[model samples]
Target: MSLAPSSAPARMPGWLLILPALLFLVAFFVLPLIDNSLRSFEVGGEFSLGRYIQLLTDTFYLGVIVETVVLSTAVTVICALIGYPVAYYLVRHAGRWSGLIVFLLIAPLLTSIIMRTYGWQVLFARRGLVNTLLVQDLGILERPLQLLNTPGIAIAALVHVLVPFMVLSIATVLQGIDQRLEEGAQMLGASRWRTFLEVTLPLSADGIGTGAILVFMIANGSFVTLVLLGGGFQTLPLFIYQQFTTTRDFGMASTMSTILLVIAMTCLYLQLRLVRRAGV
Candidate 1:
């Protein structure tokens, strides 16, 4: 007996598949951004560039912008330097212990930021473990140093919090790299260090770029960490907070936000271009 031909189910269009997400983004993300951008340009119900002009001309705001860029750059560099070696080890040598190492790296991220920042406060307190070790056990100092509420400590905390992102980014890229490439380099009489510098390192540039972008963008917007540990160090985020809370100037705040967004987007574009070029 011949069976009737079965009909295939209708397939959904690609755009229809993503319609929900697109609608959600338009409602929440895009609309809010547009509103904020509009608010930034408005002056007494009329549109103007006064806010932008004022921010660009003002020395204090310019200084904050510079400081924010510098702080983020420093954090990104430190994360890259610290993460690359760990990532290399994790990819090439961790073997059976890789899961444990990854857990250790990600564990801190699972904790609340407030809790982590407070933990840093506890460690840097007058009689905290760090001070105790330096003053009592090691006798490195006569008195406990004022380690809390300092720029250096803030940077260290940022690095500690962000290094895992860098490590994971690099590790992912490293996993895709062929071991035989390195083997061939060494087989060609290249020293291990030379092979790493010439071959492995070049191959991992995309990861470094990705990690650097992540770290830089995050450090740019870090608020609580800087507020608790930065000792009055000003950045765009801090200034934005002040504009909202202290002065209640929504226009100025939105203007600064737009500027910060532009800076971040510029960096992202540049990094993506570099990664693409490297891939080529």
Candidate 2:
């Protein structure tokens, strides 16, 4: 007698199943990107690289791009440093307060960005709580220092806004790790620090990369925080905003936008490569 076949039936092609989503992306994302890129090259009713050439030759624009990158990188590093410890604590030591801690960490995300930026504005004002303590109570300065619209304040606000993302990303990864591995390492003559360095750190590398990418991308594209907290500092996002709104220069705006897009994509690609190579 012949045996019955036991294989599963053939499934629909993966591409066919995802065709709707692919079409949506092509229509909304790819088409817009192509249009903007083409717009960036158009000038005087003809195809030209005038916008890009102008951006390259303009010292002010170049400086804004540099500042934006520096600020974004700083925010990413700060978020990682602060978030790693918080995530580790939540995963390993929160105990009874884990729920409360997680709630507090995520609560800010529910608030509007405009509201958050305004809150920072009030706190960083000349006579705000910070200056009151520094000047009146502590005598750190003779008078209120200018904190609003400053680079430091911008970084601080961005950190506050982005740290939760870092925390969540890292905590998700940490939760998936087997506690026994850490216990095993420590039981086998390894110190806590050694176990973390050798096992936990490597294991959580992917989370770190993910968090950094999210923070960096958000910070790089930020306009609200810089506007309310950066105190007249110009970044690439602000430049793009002004080009379109103030100057009515769509070509220039499109050029800066494309450049920003390229930078963000490059960083994302590099981070993924690094994460993959680390086996994370």
Candidate 3:
């Protein structure tokens, strides 16, 4: 005998709610990626990775790749260092001031990235505030220092810009941690540092992992920061931009972009594995 169908239609509305987002992703994200991947392989309708192969063979492109990796690694480490203390403070100490502190963390993020980078350009210029302070006010330097358009400046700006995301991510983790766990550790005579290392740190691993992956992805594709701050040097994103706009080499540009995407995905995958092993 056939069983009578029982209606459980509630799940259908939930799926309907997400359908718009699914359509948007398909239209904007998935389709574009597939199209770009196809474009990277073709030159006049013939399939080839000659453009990508050229990128590896070219010393300049290789250097761009190395620089991109180094910059991202440095930014991620700096963010963690700055973020951990802030995260700890917000979670444990800030109490009545937590809301304001969270707002402060988000303040710079609300500012436009291009505008922030431009602000750095002005601040770091030879005749800018930095040199004015050092040379005129402090009488420390004989000439204006070369702060603008350098790797150091780029990394500094990057850290400044991205630190909030790290803080937020870490704070999200900290918020979820049971206060009882830390109180228990303290009651058992564990030091604050010991409690953090043994309990808080482990519990917050997932948020840290998410933040690191997110920041690294942004750092790797950094075009404005690298361009304005690196002083015309090329990371992969900048190279791809130049190829597309300056040289009008769509094939090569698409290839470079594809390589960047692959690298980003690979790094994210490794981070996922690490976070899993870390038991986050």
Model number with the top TM-score: 1
lDDT of 2 by residue, 118-182 (tens): 89877879999899999999999999999887878888889999999999989988998998999
Prediction 2 global C-alpha lDDT: 0.87
For each of the candidates, the C-alpha root-mean-square deviation to the true structure, in angstroms, is 4.2, 4.8, 4.4
Reference-based TM-score of each model? 0.89, 0.84, 0.84
- Candidate 1 deviates by what RMSD? 4.2
Q: Best by lDDT, which number?
A: 1
Model 3: lDDT to the true structure? 0.84
Poorly placed runs, candidate 1 (over 4 Å): 1-14, 267-280
Lowest-lDDT window of 10 residues in candidate 1? Answer: 1-10
> What alpha-carbon RMSD in Å does predicted model 3 have with respect to the real structure?
4.4
Task: Tell me the deviation in Å of residue 32 in model 1.
Answer: 1.2
Worst lDDT 10-window in candidate 3? 1-10
Per-residue lDDT over 1-280 for candidate 3, one digit per residue giving the tens place of the 0 to 100 score? 1122234454343445578899999999989988998898897889987767877898877787887787788899999988989998998899999999988987888898899988998898999999999999999999999988777788889998888889998888788889999999999999999998998898888888888888898888878777667754567788887776689888777777888889888978977886787566
* lDDT for each residue of candidate 1 in 36-87, tens digit (9 for 90 to 100): 9889999999989998888888988788888899989999999999999999
